[model samples]
Target: MAQYKTPGVYVVEKNAFPNSVVEVATAVPAFIGYTEFSDNKGTSLAQKAWRITSMAEFNAYYGGPPQSKFSINPLPAADPKAPPVTGDFSITDSATKQRTEYELKAEGTSYILYYSMLLFFMNGGGPCYIVSVGHYGDDLDADKISAGIDTLLKEQEPTMVLVPDAVRLSAQDCTTVQTNALMHCGFKMRNRIALLDVYDGYKDRQDPAGDCVGAFREAVGTNFLDFGTAYYPWVNTSIVKEKDIDFTVITNLDVLTDLLKKELSPITDAANPTPAAKVKIDQLNAALAAITSDWTKSQDPATDKQTLNKTLLAVSSLYPQIILAIQKKLNLLPPAAGMAGLYTMVDNTRGVWKAPANISMNGVVSPTVAISNDEQEDLNVTTQGKSINAIRSFIGEGVLVWGARTLDGNSLDWRYVSVRRTMIMIEESLKQACKAYVFEPNTANTWVTIKSMARNFLTSVWKRGGLAGASPDDAFSVFVGLGETMTADDILEGLLKVSILVAVSRPAEFIEITFQQQMQKS
Candidate 1:
């Protein structure tokens, strides 16, 4: 109210509607891993939570993908009495009739944050946060990844945490990082969930050494199971293309050179060669020798790599095969990033209450390890109650996310991922909307206003099929009066309290059809 000493005609306006609750974002995920670089102009985003909306922004700040290094080595000769030795790839020289078995070993650079980002965006991911713990070639440390998870504590928009590079670490260390992430999401913040990738997820569940899922269950402790979800059998993807990699990825050029020389000897050692043929062969050999020499002499061989790579590709037919092998290795990535993107897609297209399963993943060829129906039964339900989601590929359908349970499979309340996420969304929205009424009067009027605001927000959610009920009253309840939620002493101590209950919708995970034989219908 304002007093007017010399006012001609005072005009006042009264607000008719109460303040509305704006829903907080529910799909933004925070990814923690290594990158090529983390810089914005002159600023460094290393170990910082940087928000990016598109792949372009990520590239501008974090730079492009890191260059991976691989080495092709000849397999050792096998003795006649001993078992035969095998290699990842094999090529036989027709000229010398020498069978050479070679294995491709990725050296130095194996960071996957770049490819994970590509997978996320390809699967409908939107705005996200990137926390670069270190650069490429740096050793993967559990402590560093834990520190990256800690940085998200100050941020409120990230509703999920994903450490895609954790799988590159040892199984024990990866478990340590995942445990920290779950603790941060469930116990500390209580606003997000952790998307975890099982270490050795590329291996089959029934591997001779041990079951990957069982090992994950034993190592990942039982704390905060509801706040985390794990996916098994990493998916094979086409995110890495032929142009993305070249001969430069090979660390040892000597093996490649020897193989190419032996392969080209037939043409060069001909009895009667034309002038043009001889000149072409001589020039090709000189170029190949020069490329190896320059790379060996210089500390950094990437200076003239593009030119040398072009020459190598034109000279040798083996170059494309090696590049393809590298591409295949890079394409086998963990499933956490793809799941995060699917969560975002589900939340955006259908409300957050919808389960993020039975949906095909973009840019995915198939799951590395195919899981049968019987195998998935053990994964979906266990005596220990550690549930792992599965990604399966069908003949007609490309690849789909199959299961939707959290790590705590037996909990009736928090078993489903959609239910847990919807609760978080509702809780966070109301918490933020109530901040405006913090210091207001603690009376019937204030109570009514707060209750109306919450009911309106929940009514909107219920209408969107987020809550399961016949009507608004049946869907949710909000109470804030003195007798209902607070006592006289609580009011006297300047404390205001409110209680809310919502019947969040649950997914029909299993549907059974009953059949009966009918007789004599005329």
Candidate 2:
């Protein structure tokens, strides 16, 4: 016989041996509010300690019963070519009559989405995952549910699933542990399926307390032992009956198999193709040819000759098609201009040319010695005199500076000879002329002065050419000084400096010049 010492539920097992005693305490202590027991072993224990809780009373106070009475019609057979059904599910509170409809599908259904949803309802569906797949919504509820569904589908073997909806999970009234467990299981099975009700607790509230409380209530209602409403689909009695449930059992495994095959076959074939490597090889060859063609024409001598003399003309005629190809390739000619007027200048006469190294008063290097500084000063005095006379004859009152060391054994360098010659000319021509400053060590100030003098000389020469000379528009030009061969870093720094100067000075005339007098011929 079992005797009760306190007001609580306890278990007493009868041992086969008459004198043996077996007592098992309740898994949990009796609730101060309500106490329940599984079996009536003792009359006093049933009447005094335990009470029978009615499922109706539980439903009236809490939400309506879960879908225990209802059964899920097995998923409909998939029609590969058939247009998908577009309807979604609508949930309504029996007491409040408030209903919310979620759009189900815009895109066609997948096996994972169908199977997961069917399984949830079949396995005593409590709360389900619903996703509003058709249209986008501003509410976060839909997004959360969609994510839950995706997570479920990715699982290796998911036991539970989530539905997609605009409602957020935090808004749903459900227990964290229960909801989380369902989500985890769903993720394990197939993540694409989602439940709509999960986001109901998150409503307008910002905190999780309401959601958590709701989840707890949901969990309590969903307890396996508790007699509560169970999840069931809205079935059509005309097409199926509860006892004849097997009729709706979709046995057309071909649909899923075919879909899986179609989806996976392309991926496998794409991974290893018989002719893919050959196609890639052909594409690579085509690209190489294009690159080579561009490179060859860029430096073609016959296409870009400095002079259009008879020899050059003959060469051009021989490669007329090549020249045309280069012109088209480079895009150097504007649409209206064409190539007829493009003439290269050639000087056939060997006149009294100044040494190439001779730096003229107008800051231009004489064509003869302009090729090198050393060769300029090495010119005989007769040649030097004739060069200066030619400049004076052509343009009055200009400076002629010897710019290189003469090959003669004389120790005099061209720079000194050029400066002295200029000073003499200035003294004879203009009484007030004077050498502003000479660059002995090539400081920043000396470089600035040199630049200013060169600019002034070029301006004078251009003015002397009257209107026929190149116009001094506001075109930006770059000039590299012959002080040293510029490395990439040096060039970059120089460009930066020029940009700064242009921005700050806002000069009317901008030009870039390179003095390669000191550079090797190459």
Candidate 3:
């Protein structure tokens, strides 16, 4: 109503009905790890969140995966013909006039972020955030990793947290970081979930019932365990190729050159042979002696250093290659990143209630630990309530996420990952929609509108097979009022409480069939 005398016609169209809840993004995970490089345009992205949509986007912002290295001291009586550590490690064997000989060798460790990124995008992960705690050269300590997860505290869009590189830390440190991640996801945010990876020792497929499982349980502890889920054992992936790894070896070049000079010095031609043969030997010896540090240097002053650097495989480039090669030896890796991708895929294709299991994983050759039914029995249902899911490869079905339990394996209510995740989705969606009611009078009108809004949103979820009931009434209930969800004193203090209950669908983990003999109708 305006002053009638001077006012002209002013029509304002407003929302006629209650505002509905906008379902929160369920699969946008924030990955915390060490990156080869993290930059957008030119600014550094260290300890900050960067959104990436595809592998191309990841490459554009953060450089491709990094190389890991392994230094191996030759064993007793080194064999000159020993196979290279990786397919490309360099070997060196040399002998002096005194018959003294020695050797050297090297290997690669592929950057978890790079190959894991490839696997994630190939499977089904979409726009997600990445926190590059440090560059490849920086120390990948638990502190750096903890800081990375901490950066996500300011971000609200990411609903899941993953730290694929955490396995690289010490077992004790790994527990600390994982504990922090769980607290961040479960206690602090309450809207997000944490995905964990078992330690690398579990990658030894021979240790299905190894002490590492118990070690993991002891380290992670029981506090806020329900907020997280861990998948084991690790997985062997085809995402990383030898070329992708770019391994560099300190080959037998120097050794071969030394050996050649040693053998040439004792040639019969050199001892008492013809003058021409002796001259030829002398010339060859001179040539061998000329192979000095400057031999690889270019003649041009401008190109000398650059050429030598390239020819020598400068410390920066070759070190990564060395590392990448070592990592390639055991191609199996932690499962958190790949599982994050699968979660995104399942959430997008089906509702969140659909357990992300029994589906073939892309780019997965096989699981590091072959968890047979018998082996998984202990892992999936342990007395300690630290259930580890199995990523098993079937005879014909390929590799699948065979289990769906959360870390709180013994809790009847928060037992399944789907149930926990579905509730988180609902809670986040309603919380966001309630923002409109902030500062508004907390009265009966507000309660009714909130209830209606929630009902409409949940009814749609029910239709989508997220709820387990036969109808909307059976599937969920909403309570928000003075006497119901809030008391008079609660309303006076501006605390408008709204309670909601929903029957989340669980995965049919086991099916039973019963048969009885019947008399034949003759």
Query: All candidates' TM-scores?
Result: 0.92, 0.12, 0.80
lDDT of all predictions: 0.90, 0.25, 0.76
lDDT-superior candidate, 1 or 3: 1
For candidate 3, give the lDDT of residue 72: 38
- How far in Å is the alpha carbon of 357 misplaced in model 2? 99
Off by over 4 Å in 2: 1-52, 60-85, 88-522
Model 1 ranges off by over 4 Å = 1-13, 77-86, 93-98, 266-287, 295-315
Q: After superposition, how far is residue 148 of candidate 3 from its true place, in Å?
A: 1.3
lDDT of 1 by residue, 312-416 (tens): 677667776778788889999999999999999999999899999999999998899998899899999999999999999988988999999999999999999
Single out the weakest 10-residue window by summed lDDT for candidate 1. 294-303
Candidate closest to the true structure, highest TM-score: 1
lDDT of 2 by residue, 245-303 (tens): 21112233233223223323333346565575445434433433433233335556443
Candidate 3 residue lDDT tens string, 1-522: 555676587777877799978898899989988888888778999889999899888888888766444443434444569842333333332333223323233333334777777788878989899998888776668998898898998999998898888887777898889999999988888888899988764455454555676678888888887889998877878776543332123343354344445444445334578776566565545444444445544467345433433332331233334445544554667778888899999999997999999988998887766667888898899899889888889898999999999999999999899999999998889889999999989988888898999999999999999998989999999999988988889988989999888998889999999999999999
What's the true lDDT of residue 144 in model 3?
84
Estimate the TM-score for candidate 2: 0.12
Displacement of residue 53 (Cα, Å) in model 3 is 0.8
Ranking by TM-score: 1, 3, 2
